[model samples]
Target: MPRPTPSPRPRRLGVAAALAVALTLVGGCGTTSSSGNLKVYQQEQFEPGETFSRMFDASVSQTCEAARRALLSQGYIVTVLRPDAINGSKNFQPGGEAHVQITFNIVCTDDGNQGKLSSAYVSATQDRYTLKKSPNSASVGVSAIGSLSIPFASTDDSLVKVASETIPAGVFYDRFFALMASHLKELQMDAAVD
Candidate 1:
């Protein structure tokens, strides 16, 4: 027995479907406005500490988080947050007591269609030292002395600069909306075609 042939309408529908798929693929490839698809989220900051060591951690955490949030608002996805220690030292006072100094590390990551884009480790530290005087000393003993140290403190500055320079909201939106308008133009062109 001879098999029934497929209807012409079915064959036309199949061709139309294939053509739609091809057009979509071509459109996606030709369009450079992937910027509109980008998304930015919030930034995170670390905690503060009482002591030098803890303060160092706090500084980095706070700064890095701020940077992360800024980037997120610009559509970058944060992936990591970690601290790096720079140097440790001791400060000696006239009385015979010593203080310790420490620094912190900053790391952040972002996700994109291409891959993960990450910022470099930004470092920040805050150190405090207190000196104690000997009671036996005849001279009026100093009650206490204090000092603080911070390294890589400029991370915040750099982050701010980058954010301002890279993600100007006015400029970004203008370009984004313009690209969208162009896509609409393409759609209109397609619609006008027979």
Candidate 2:
């Protein structure tokens, strides 16, 4: 009995088969799935003129009044009012032990726009506070068949300052400018009537 020898053609075909499989695997590795949503995020940019160049062609008193009216409309408590400046603040209690507040300070410059232009400098300060609970004792005593004194269940809560930041100029000022514009128009109408 004699063993049959392998043919050279078959060996070549086997090599070709292995090479084909290797090529297929390598080709599949370079492909990626095309079924995903992609999004690009860019930082917000604010123009300097848009942020601070809001000018109302009205008198200082009229412009300040407009700012006051605008602040009042947006639930701001007007704390300080002057001929050239307005200050307002609002408080928010979001949840337990958390308190947040934003204060708006607007300074108007009367640079003699022929008494026609008043420019408001807008800025805001954001403050956050947390409530601190402290236990206090009241006079505790017991009087039989008479008034009985008990420990106070009421806890005193004081606000502890946590953080504060100055808001930068941006579209956050657009509303203020819009409000001032509306008020300026009304003021002009009033002056025209007088």
Candidate 3:
């Protein structure tokens, strides 16, 4: 009788199998924490004409409030304001040109299996401007993703930082707002406001 031949297993196949098994086990191991306790502190609305101090305070307040509401939906315990006062500024031109600047001082602490993790963050001066008003205010859609070092902090802080740092103050007014205006009629017909 002729000798029976055995099937050969490729080296790559063995390595790939091991990698997949390792990834599966690692992915299933750790539990992430819930971000249900963050608090937000809003300053107040800063209009175009006001003392520099008051205007700045209002800007910080508005930004903090907006950030807080957005973050809450994602399950974060955020404190929008610091113990010390923050400063902000907003400028508006006659032809619907507007500029805004906001700064923040933040301190946060959270507990996880690795131990308590705390960080102090200072996000300084996010400025934006708008040139034209939108006909359909609802058309403006702002979204952010933020994340902390904690196991379950799902928010991507990098997005927030990018929005703050890179977006020009008045680009929305010139572009996004204009788009909203052109689409207002259609938007109203299709959507109902509460």
Ranking by TM-score: 2, 1, 3
lDDT of 2 by residue, 36-79 (tens): 32321223345555465467778788888888998998899999
- The better-scoring model by TM-score among 1 and 3 is 1
Stretches off by above 4 angstroms in model 1 are: 1-100, 111-113, 134-194
* Per-residue alpha-carbon lDDT of candidate 1 for residues 1-194, written as tens digits (9 for 90 to 100): 99998789989999999999999987875643455442232222233421112111123333344444444444433444444212222222333333433332334333232332223233333354554332221234345744433343222211111111112224433443343334444544655693
Which sections of candidate 3 miss by over 4 Å? 1-96, 108-119, 133-163, 166-194
Deviation (Å) of 36 in candidate 2: 34
Clash list (residue pairs), candidate 1: 39-75, 40-72, 40-75, 41-72, 42-69, 43-69, 44-65, 46-61, 46-62, 84-105
lDDT of 3 by residue, 1-194 (tens): 99977556667788999999998776654332244332222223355432121111122323233334333443444444443332233332333344444443332332232422222222334545454332321233345544333234233322112224423234432342233233433333444562
Better of 1 and 2 by TM-score: 2
TM-score of each model, paired residue for residue: 0.20, 0.65, 0.19
Decoy 1 TM-score against native:
0.20
Candidate 1: 10-residue stretch with minimal lDDT: 157-166
TM-score of 3: 0.19
lDDT on C-alpha atoms for all candidate structures: 0.38, 0.82, 0.36
Backbone-clash count (model 2): 0
